[model samples]
Target: MTVPAHHPAPELLLDYAAGSLRAVQSLLVAAHLAYCPECRAQVAELEACGGVLLADLPPEPVSDSLFGTLMTRLDATVATPTPVPAPAGKSLFPGPLRRAIGAEPEALEWVRVVPGVHLSAWGVSAGTASACLLRMAPGSRVPAHRHTDSEMLLVMKGGFSDEFGAYRVGDVASYDTGTPHHAVADADGECLCLLVQDQPLVFTGPLGWLLNRGFRF
Candidate 1:
């Protein structure tokens, strides 16, 4: 994929630097950073600012028993290192996402969302949000839907387009509750993306009703 022209907003980058973004949001940002050097520079600057702030804080005295307590715990315990996930060959997912999903994209079992559209929800639990890989057949059109919470879509293969603009590989499309748009996959090939939603979508119209009945979001 070519260098990404679109990126996560500055506010999102700041939140990421501050460790205030939700887990999935952070993962999305990390994946973008892997492909975007400009954003990586911005995040590095933010971290430097945070380091300066930390250095300026006044030091506090430690409790009298703190040293003894730490020594006793250290002597009594054996720390086990955390296990790391192995790479799944050539994959579109960045490190964090690969760790979360634990397999190559082709290995996942996808469920049909609608005709010509399928998805594989993240195996791990999400806090107040949901993350998944959505796959759309060439020339397919996703039903028009509006969000109840924020949504971020990062294209990993092929392309898709909505009213905002066409998004190719490595491009990101973010939407808040008020932005309602239907996406159509490019006719050339299937479109694959990692989609993170802060809350379930509130799809519009009769078609939405049927879809909502069959699927939770």
Candidate 2:
């Protein structure tokens, strides 16, 4: 696999290291880390810095009630063992994503949202945020759209290019609310990506208006 030129911003990495990111966001970052040695190293550095800062801080006493609650939760967890799902057959998906979806991309059912574009929801969400997989046929173009809150896309296969730039496998692209753009899959092959969004997308233009009336991304 080619080394990725794109990565999550420093602030996002810090939030990830601090365990502050939402479940869906963390999953996207973890998927990116599976393919990005550079981001992995950066995360390790952040963790080390966090540890140093923690060591410098004075210890705070935990309340007895809180400790007891934690102990009870641990005991209950041990008493009721959660079953781990069997691993799906070999796939191109990263470990984090494969574990989350519990199936290969090709094995999952896809729903067409538009011409040459399909989506498979993973049913994972945090508050208003949600996660899904997007598959685009070769040379297909998505309608222009803007995010309502925040959106993150991690390339899992092939590539795509937008107004921002091109993104290949392992690259992560983040968009803030109101940022408008459209992406076209590379002509050479299909594009598969993991998408995590804080809110649904709002489309633009004539085709977009028609799509928005009937569909919700």
Candidate 3:
């Protein structure tokens, strides 16, 4: 595994520790932590802090109907587990993504965004969150774009670089609506990344208007 050069923001780590982040964000964070020991340690510390804070809170009593209502809801709701793929030799893909995608990396059916770039979107809730696998060939570039909500990128293989910095395998690059930047894959090899976003992106470049029409980004 390559050492990560970037990581999720501190606020995100805090949200993750408190279980307050959305499922898509958690999925990206979990995938990053699979290879980032530095972040794992940070999360451990944050969890400890959360534990202390929780312990200090005063206890509250629940309504008499709370348990019955909870049970009723549980009985009414159905659980859908993410399908797991059969072992396909050894895979470098993260467990969380592998489960959600339900297949090995090579098995993903990617949609071409442009030459040398492709995407495989997951069926996460619409307008709430989105998760996908972005594969870029060596030297490929994603046109400059900004997000309406928070977005996170976790490199699974190879690497890419943006205005913020270079990111190798295991690195996580997190951004918000404020920053607009383009990314280019490393020249050495193809790059595979797990990308999670809460809202659509707003492309900002010469081709912004055209790209947005096609990608709805």
Candidate 1, superposed: residue stretches over 4 Å from native:
64-88, 123-125
Model 3: residue 138 alpha-carbon error in angstroms: 0.6
The TM-score that candidate 1 achieves is 0.86
lDDT tens digits, residues 1-217, model 3? 5667688888888899999987888888888888888989999999999989999999898999999999999999897687785666667787776666777768767777767888774445445788878899999998778777877889999999998899998889888766787899999999999888787666777877766654543
Candidate 1's error at 178, in angstroms? 1.9
Cα RMSD for candidates in order? 2.7, 3.8, 4.9
* Residue-wise C-alpha lDDT for candidate 1, range 61-135, written one tens digit per residue: 899999999999998988768867564678777767877887887888887778888878554437877778889
lDDT of 2 by residue, 1-217 (tens): 7899999888888999988987888999999999999999999999999999999999998786998899888888757568886765668899988888878877888777788988785547778888898899999987778777888889999999999999999999888888887899999999999988898777777677666643354
Alpha-carbon runs more than 4 Å astray in model 2: 61-89, 207-210, 213-217
Q: Residue 168's C-alpha lDDT in candidate 3?
A: 90
Best-matching candidate per TM-score: 1
Q: Highest lDDT: give the candidate number.
A: 2
lDDT for each candidate structure? 0.83, 0.86, 0.82
Kindly indicate the candidate among 1 and 3 with the higher lDDT: 1
Model 2 gets an lDDT of 0.86
